[model samples]
Target: MEEVLKKFKPRVVSTGIKELDEMMGSGLLDDSTLLVIYDASSFGWTIGVQVFRRMIELGGFGVITSYSFPISLLEKYALTMQYDFLRDGAEGNLAIVDVIGSIYNLNVNLPFVYYPGSIDSETFLAKMEAVYRRIMKERADSRKPVGISVTVDALPDLFGEDVAMRILRRNLLMKELALMREERERPINILLLNRERASRRFIEWLSQYAEHIVEFRSTSISGVERMIARKSLLPSFTPSEAEFRFEHGNIEIRPL
Candidate 1:
């Protein structure tokens, strides 16, 4: 047991929210995939902010495969998160794989790669593969452990409800993504979605692939929201919920 533990070396990575981190047993296990399911009443935006901000702060990197927003809006996200998107891009700390314009046939002008065509699971997987290879090659000599947090922002917003459902049904893409993350090592992926928009079947299927499931909802107390988390691997930690207040560009997870 001691040898196995030493070989695997439990390296926990933060989500950038201290209280939530404590709830997650001091942070998530390296390479664990966290899926964020949020309704309109919840503070879903903080999902991206916390994961990537912590990754960048740790001298790691972040890759955003966004279908909801373009590069311009992403820049605003960076400013809101207090991180520099362009500077991070230049310094090899960020990569954006854009699929926003593809859904609407608009030519998006951005420094990162853009797939300006109809999106499907195949297209998403191909673009992600390319992005990962690019990051790996560019940081071949770095000793930073190749830790990267990938955010797949608002999938339903990208493919529309029916198409997003079909794409989500593609189990091959999820399997391939899992394999790729393990092969690269320390690749933590956070899949964000609008709970009210996406089908329940799709969410259930996706949850099978995710190591952790985080659902956000509104609370009775005004100005506060709830985060219900379920960990697949950590059985001792049972399902728990946390309350948070989102204001002044910060999310403070309140103690229960």
Candidate 2:
């Protein structure tokens, strides 16, 4: 285990929230899978963009699979969060797969498919297979490990608990398949927004496939939030209480 860790020293990527990053010892690992649980109003998109931005800054590619936000909305939010959308090489490195978009747009540049917001599991699975093939081809042609962010907002509305579990399971399996084929690690980040159907059993099952789990909660302090990590692969260190603040977005330790 120590040998493997040393060989694959975890890379930390900040979430743009200082307090959250501090709690996780600088940031999340680059090649590991992470699950982010929060509500729509809980700054989930903000965190997702931050992770994508970090990947872009590192000259890496990322994919955002949005089940709720439209492409236009995602673009708007990303720009609002200070991401430069018009910059050269932006589209080349960042790919947004908006299921809300028309199917015609899927054939453009990247191999993406649109779901049209109304589809059965079988149909959805077929479209996903095409997308997966395209992604693999793209990665092969570009020879870059892509960071995939799959945001399934209001999951319960899309599929039943059993169906959702199956979808998620297949997604993770597909990621692993890509990882093996590319001879590179593909980090898949899942954002479950306000998904009440996601029971503890489901989460526990998912946890086995995840390397990190980040839970975000809002605080009374303005511009501040609390983040907790259920699992991590980093060296442990005691945090000082003075280092944390409610408004300033700092994470500090205090006497219990």
Candidate 3:
């Protein structure tokens, strides 16, 4: 029998937690997407913020599509770590896409525009693609590998029941687009979903697009939860389970 060759893909993004990385096949593969399901009391927001901070440290670009809370909250979260979130945003290292500000009737004074109303699937995808391209162009001179991290915070909550099905359908399509837009091996896509609030059907469909899945389970005890992290690329992987806490600008994932 003849042996077949496989192309190599590097793992460029790290979860910043040593144990979690060892469990997740040495962090996420380059150009791969991760789906994170977090409960109300878990550290979902911490995961997203850390990814953004990593991008900044690497001199890479990031896009954060906020559908759950104001980007200001993320900024405040970063402040605890002694990070100047506003300075980074002004330098074009990160772009915050505020999708729910207008819908919630809050006056957001950011350099970017907010949807301010119900957002459809089409518009959301377009805005994402545009920000991605703009960032890539700005960094063309550096000729660095396009390391782009996209974080979508609480997707389903962005729309109404009337457009629920449409959003799901569009999400399926967006996943396809994400797979198609891999220019070189340098993209990191992250989707943070509120598992308690997300429908099972929606999750089932979205999981199809995720290369890695990390689920956070809340416990009866406050401020502590369990994390089950797995990688799809490694079929032999036994999901690593751990108890973690997101506090004081740090995430600690300890073996359960």
| Candidate achieving the largest TM-score | 1
TM-score of 2: 0.68
lDDT of 3 by residue, 54-117 (tens): 7557665655666666667756756876677667767756556565664566756766323434
Candidate order by TM-score, decreasing, is 1, 3, 2
The weakest ten consecutive residues by lDDT in model 1 span: 143-152
lDDT of 1 by residue, 1-256 (tens): 6654453564676776676666666666666667777776666657656776676677766666666776677678667656676776666666666666666676656454435356465586555556556755665335233222223335655556566656655634664555444444456667776767667766786788777677788868887777777664554456777786777677677656
Alpha-carbon runs more than 4 Å astray in model 3: 1-12, 80-83, 102-122, 139-154, 160-185
TM-score: the better of candidates 2 and 3: 3
Scored by CA lDDT, what does every candidate get? Answer: 0.62, 0.54, 0.61
Which segments of candidate 1 are over 4 A away from where they belong? 1-11, 102-124, 139-184
Candidate 3: give the clashing pairs. 102-116
Candidate 1, residue 138: Cα displacement in angstroms equals 2.8
| Residue 245 miss distance in model 2 (angstroms) | 9.2
TM-score of each: 0.76, 0.68, 0.74
